[model samples]
Target: MTSPLYGQMMEVPLLASSLLSHASRHFGDIEIVSRRIEGDIHRYTYRDCEKRAKQLAQALIALGVEQGERIGTLAWNGYRHLECYYGVPGMGAVCHTINPRLFPDQIAFIIDHANDSYVFFDMTFWQLVENIAPLCPNVKGWIALGDEGCMAQFRADMSVPVQSYETLIGAQDGDFEWPELDERQAPILCYTSGTTGNPKGALYSHRSTVLHAYAAALPDAMSASSSDAILPVVPMFHVNAWGIPHAAPLAGAKLVLPGKDLDGKSLYDLMEAEGVTFSAGVPTVWLGLLSYMKSEGVRFSTLKRTVIGGSACPPAMLRMFEDEYGVDVIHAWGMTEMSPLGPLARLNHRQKQRPLEDQRRSLEKQGHTLFGVDMKVVGEDGRDLPWDGKSFGNLHVRGHCVIDRYFRREELPLVDGWFPTGDVATIDADGFMQITDRSKDVIKSGGEWISSIDLENIAVSHPQVAEAVCIACAHPKWTERPLIVAVLKPGATVTREELLAHFQGKVAKWWIPDDVVFATELPHTATGKLQKVRLREAYRDYVLPGAVESDA
Candidate 1:
């Protein structure tokens, strides 16, 4: 007989709603910590957060905000943002997250496109609010998510009615019921990063969000628990901070907020002050923290686990945290469409006997797909490749949480019930998946596909390199060539010849970078992933040997 499916699909109560009641029921005293702009730390319990969410919901309704209307927030990862995550949705309204790092035009477009009726913003986004308010004519009011004393600095706004978030919460009732949801109805709408084209909204339904959150808190995913003092350094505007806010509360994890300031110093201070045990953010955020620790002679005394996603975590960065800092860095991989849950690097019991170095090397792969997620690799012929690690193919995924289509832009390209992730990868016999390249980032040299990711990883492993970027440049003999950009560590120097020599014995000599360009820093995406497109555009006109210079 076929093995029965192990995972169960059950209708649990609304996570936030249940958690608040539970906090009041059992864990009422657990603290939710946040460092606010008032220069004082704010501490509350889940019971308080639940009551405040209800109050916010009541306040929104009293303000003539109706269910199904869009509510937008331009704030940081904090307690207030967490309130909006539940309050708006519980009241049957959709929460649209606007990326603060997006260009002014894009931000305006997303707000207008979502038809947001009200905006909750942070004090730091005052100038951004002023510039974009006129463009978003549908927004009837703006609430600054600040304490009473800190609201004065943000009161100088334009045409919209500016209100204090504290005042609204203080004046409302905290006894509203969350309407029963269709589960398929849109609850959250987040836009794609728009690196290639116009940003399209990936609207998530209540069911998808809830399912993804369940997966996120699983043993292999985030493995969050009530004991985990979780700090999501990822921005709330980006894929629901990789769904951490939703999952953490569902698991009753104590929430720690770093607020609007995410610099290394501020983050480290919060982690230490809050006694955060588990955290999740991109590699760049942790990279800064690692550098800060090195410079200031600090260490992560309280932090025990970290989740690195939004981009591939360099093995060196992972090693630093796991080996040196004594914090486990779980390499995660996902995208906006997957509700950001695809794979996680959880070492099984079998791998525990391996050497630390070997374990680290295995963890660098994206790890096994979660229970609800199913993954496959497809070659150019659209045939599924074996999960044998040796075969590199385009990665395709289909699952419960994976988005079926884009909002307002149906006809999304789909094949055989799977969504093309645009990622190239290799799957080992044991089910560990390693991303080789982005479909667009792969370089074709002399009709052979070269993974720039592999090339850059090798280059950065050199002692002198601090950062690296690999892009395809014009080649006279090969049509397209791989160009490596290297950023040196402080007080370190190496020429192109010296770096190429280091990689000579490791990779094929022909696969080595033909020309190495040194730089002070590498540009990164809003989510902290290396922006290879920017690197390509920045050096588009580079002249290569025996090649003509042409703008890419």
Candidate 2:
């Protein structure tokens, strides 16, 4: 109310400022625990993390890191990563998170593209550090974010000066003052997984990220609270661990970081030990953990809820967690452009009393849009469609946080304020949105779009199938058609005939897969989503029964 433009500018403090402010004033005693180099645990409180981040700020200043400079980090989820999350941004520098899983060339490209001047690495990434060091021209220093023993080889390999993270922090006076930051300044940069085209980067502002964290902590979203110990199985490199690290402190949640080792046993052990009640990740992690729990006879005493996104979770997996393990699994859907937490899959108050099976059916949707988001489905003519569930169209999303441009690609597609999500979806009467398929992944047969996801879901519903991938293969008459590739479960056998028969009553006859191919496994994306593009490439020459190949 002070100024006419004050309404447009939400005068919230910077993300680092808010994170430190909360930790110091309200939840100083909340614990932040990490698994250490030894077979032991290192524990600290929010109070300790705040002090350490300040010490890190002081050390960065001592090392001559200037404002707006890029600082890259290759680290796993741990208290140290958390420190950099706040410390780097607190010093008015952008935190460039390097995904260790990316191909070496891609990794080199991101490092150079960001023009990072300083690098930090965990002990696990020493060899990788050696590999890409030469390509980073602007980088002048290497900081080993681990113990002194781990820094020996790293320091020797680095052409520039190298310092141990422990020694640097120990040497700092911890008397650094926080920098004044404009809320609109870039706080973080995340690149999309380049499956369709070249990877594109999206810059996030301090204000935007802080608002996203607040929205993420809503009851309809992650619903985090101070009493909760949160475990984000999602990687920190991906959309800021879906903004958990930022949201956790704002809500006073105790944080648990499962550094490096994300295997089934390690995650379960950490979850159990830390009393983690809620977690989020892609479906693959939960599947692996479920298998491990059955094989090792391990159970989560505290983990009661999991938020699954990045791909559609198998209904069976959702059922197993809900029915067998007494854990609730909620399916979520969003893109990197939307700051990653766009829609949450939750039943409304009216649907809460529905039958369990009916309830689960509703929960499988991407759920209703969040508070500040708006969605519309557009037809080929760019006209809006009714929310009748049966009317499918390309989904267009527009919001304050939705990205309007890629970092450097001014020519990339944009229509008005709306960003085409490149996803085809159907909105039900109840306002829940269900994604039919990605635009590029849809199979067109006889001029009708067939959702590969729908076919794969049907295929996996059969007891014999362990996993299924549907991709379009060149068709002589139909132009393009879907071929279902199925991976069978152990000791299970189902022929193509039997599987086709399962879809007879479930879907339209024409929508049935033209052919079914048996396989041991389906390829997956770097983030563990099913790699349909690879599947299409592998079967581009698929031959279906009674169809002839054309030279044209």
Candidate 3:
């Protein structure tokens, strides 16, 4: 005979709509700000956002959007887009955010693959939508996120029946009740920018998204709170703007959305104007902001912390933010498949007690896991590697937010219940995870592996170097040797020998790049990660000097 369990609570489903409801009820008066692409500022409150979201939901329902159907958004970070984040999922329809930065062909492919019933886009992407609309036959209608005049202009230019987002929502009242939805039902779909082939969709469940938001708002995670004015320089299309869209509302934080104006001056001006206390973006973005601020001798007044991801944040960047600007740079790591947030680099109390230099070194790592995610490194033979801070292996993660399978694909990407992250990393005894290299980008020289990330990081730390990437070049003796492709700061000059000399004491002699190639710019992905695949292709036939072909 089994005993009955006591203290059981109500079995309410963890729907995404609840987040909006909670924000409206508790943080109704908090401001949600947006710097629009039209060179203007749009301001509203949580109450307004929630009401508009409900109106949008009613609009979608009137448009005949069925439950669990996919609705696509091709827009920037703004209040309207934020409304859809709740509106689409809140009504049990999946929100598929298409990255307009992707190639037109890729965009068409994604729309067709998702079979989106309707596509909502901004005025800035009018030409893009017009170009790709014919390619995506599944898209039944189009909604331009603008006023009636803007919609009329779009309609005049296109053959499709385009509706104005404002008109549709304004026609509806906000009294519609949200339908009950299973927590495990898919509510959001984001595609990975695949290095090869087409992008694959990562359909996220309501439960996973809500859990990720909770974890992201924790003290060790993004540390989102009501007192902070949050600025997400990261685009909303990129991993839900690193999950800040959800986490900000959940924490009742004031959100400052920089819509398509990520330039240094634009970002700096907006941060100052909004009194931004915390922000999140990629290293390339911060590099520009730092350069602009340094050149102007300007400093942050209210900005305190920033979360850097999309790629590894260099140690020099971490230091510059901390030492010069008095800002904390939190290095983070995640992928599209993991609701895009996992480990965040925040030092514990004991770790903070160490020497500043030592603490900075630890902070340079990707970070330790958040509460919901579990990580481990495994060797080639599938055995778990030791967490001694030196053993590098393929990183594997399992968590409530981790994806078990891709959207519309039945194949499972897991190995023994763990999702392989394709990242070569080391987990130290203290739980700090450092990414040595991408598994495909690791440079092998003379039967030993060299970290391209390390080489790139060290090169960028030089005062004159603006950006850097390390790629493997063919060598006769070593088979493959590291080559540095560097972009210099404007008007700055440095010799290849001088650049190589800068790495002399920081890394092993063999790990240093054998040669340097100067360039005005380097290619990067839409999400701001270094496009190493393109770099590898560009330097594929390059031969290292003083090296002979191996006969064996």
Output the number of the lDDT-best candidate. 3
Span of ten consecutive residues with least summed lDDT in model 1 = 11-20
Candidate 2: where are CA atoms >4 Å away?
Answer: 1-14, 37-39, 153-161, 549-552
Better of 2 and 3 by TM-score: 3
- Reference-based lDDT, each prediction: 0.83, 0.83, 0.91
For candidate 1, write residues 1-552 as lDDT tens digits.
534875565656443345445654576777788877565678898888888988998998998888778999998887888899888887778889889898888889989988999999987887898898889888888888876678666565454567889998889879777766666677788999888877888888787787888889998789989888988898889999988888877788888888877888989988998889999998778777887888899888789898998887888788778778899888989989888878899989888788987777789989989877899999999999998888988999988878888877759757888999999999987799999899999888889888898888888778778888889987877878888888898998688889878778777776877788888888877667788889888888887755653333
Per-residue lDDT of 1-552 in model 2, one digit per residue for the tens? 387755676555656567766866799888988886434688999888888888888888888888888888888888888888888888888888878877777777888888888888887777787788787777877788876776675566665556788888888766777777888888788888888766778888888888888888898888889889999989888878988989999999999888777889889989998899999999878867887898898777998798999998777778888888899887888888888777788888988998987888888788888876789888988998999988999999887777778877767566766889999999988888889999988888879899988888888878778788888888888888788899887788789899888889878888988889998888887778988888888887778875774434
Q: For each candidate, C-alpha RMSD in Å? A: 3.6, 2.5, 1.6
Candidate 3 global CA lDDT score = 0.91
- State how far residue 282 of model 2 sits from its true place (Å): 0.3
- List TM-scores for all candidates, in order: 0.94, 0.94, 0.98
